[model samples]
Target: MQTSPPDPDDLALFRDFVAGTRPLEQDKIAPVVKRSKQKRPAATSNSSTAEKLFFFSDEFEVFAETQGTLSYVQNGDDPHLAGRLRRGELEPQVVLDLHGMTAQQAKTELAGLLNYCEQQQLNCACVVHGKGLGILARKVPNWLIQHPNVRAFHTAPRSWGKHGALLLLLKINQSTEQQFRELTRR
Candidate 1:
């Protein structure tokens, strides 16, 4: 039996095969390389929807009810917000008492109040849409359902006002919010 050292050509051929320069004879054993990249969650959902709700918004905030998180710039009554509030540079944060007004009146008042609040750059707001008297008398006002400015509103926390009122996450003018952002950054 003749035992000989391996040829240089065989070693080079093996290296080429390992590097994938030469195709494997066994087609089924060939390793698959994924050529395409994955689509982003937002993009896979749709481009139109992507613009509608992105990671952040100047006018609106991303709120997760389950997680109880808010995306708005929080000044936290620190020196910045307190100073702005004192100088009338920022709008006050309070729950508007709309308890007794009829739905029609409430609707009109809502429009006016929202306009005023936004123009003044007020961020924190609460609307007291009281739970109907005694029994389940009526549904939430039709006007509230139709209002355009109301982005996201929900029942107040138990201590503040409960189901009788709602805490409105109001939208502010982009320019006014820019000031808030500046103050926050500073």
Candidate 2:
């Protein structure tokens, strides 16, 4: 089969960028799996009837659930997956920090981050809401519970930010799902 030649202008532009940048030694990034970009997980009408257990009083505070305590939740059917995440067996690929940002700002940024993660087919990410007065820390988990794109989240390990951050496990990418189905069909 015939093929077109590489674009000369693109090659020169790429070369210029590479020449100006320092060499990155083997970041060991994984190849991304292409996926159908679903807008969000469908919030069934049944969600309206779902129990609202995420509430806490204004005087209450947030903290990382202590070790040996269950600290993760997954809406999916995989029961043990959340436990694995909390134990740090499933590491995050990226982190989104909401330290100084206001609640509204954090929410906006998280929405964008979840969408971006979905598009990139990232399975895991972390959201750092520092343990300042605890407002952000408390609200972050509630917001994540409402986020349609998130499959699961847990309190991060001490080195990862302890109660100040959360490690998230996103749903499988649609492309990955399709690939799985195709492979099984054969």
Candidate 3:
């Protein structure tokens, strides 16, 4: 007895069923994904103090509410600092640039500058520290960043010196100057 060959239509139908069960081609699946709706994350509510901006100084640290942490912090935090700097509260003083100065140099120079700013009752001063020579010199420039007399050493605005300089808000001894006058009179 001889077995009959399958029908042409049945053979075609079986081939199609086998192909369908096999892993789909990547290109075919990509188009299906493109047509599907993409679910996105919902926007988070603005609800925390850390999300707001913060400002601090040697003598004070003021926590203020702000819409964004990226805004101009100097003016937004305390108008007093900006006002005094603009009004020349410490202009009569001197500015010392310690760009290439070592840690020891910065320490020595800073002491002298602070004393001078205090004694002379001068205000506006510039301490220019070149953006570190290269990478490995991270904490070197930060010396001035922690000084007490440094009222606010922000990256200077366009009208002021640029990143290469720091505008100090010195805390001088008003009493010392007044005392000098009294001693001279006596």
lDDT of 2 by residue, 94-145 (tens): 8998989987677667766776787788878988888788767766776676
Error of 2 at 60 (Å): 15
Ranking by lDDT: 2, 1, 3
Q: Report the C-alpha displacement of residue 27, candidate 1, in angstroms.
A: 99
The 0-to-1 C-alpha lDDT of every candidate, in the order given, reads 0.49, 0.69, 0.48
Model 1 alpha-carbon drift over 4 Å, by segment: 1-92, 134-142, 179-186
Against the true structure, what is each candidate's TM-score? 0.41, 0.56, 0.41
Candidate 2 residue 104 C-alpha distance from true site, Å? 0.9
Reference-based TM-score, model 3: 0.41
User: Model 2: runs farther than 4 Å from truth?
Assistant: 1-70, 174-186
- lDDT leader: 2
Q: Rank by TM-score, descending?
A: 2, 1, 3
- What is the model-wide C-alpha lDDT for candidate 3? 0.48
Across 24-69, the per-residue lDDT of candidate 3 in tens digits comes to: 5667433453554877756534342212211112233231321111
lDDT of 1 by residue, 1-186 (tens): 998989999999888878846554865766899866876555234463443233222233232131221122233323333233223343337667667787545545565566667677676566666665611112232233333444444445655455565555455777866776797566
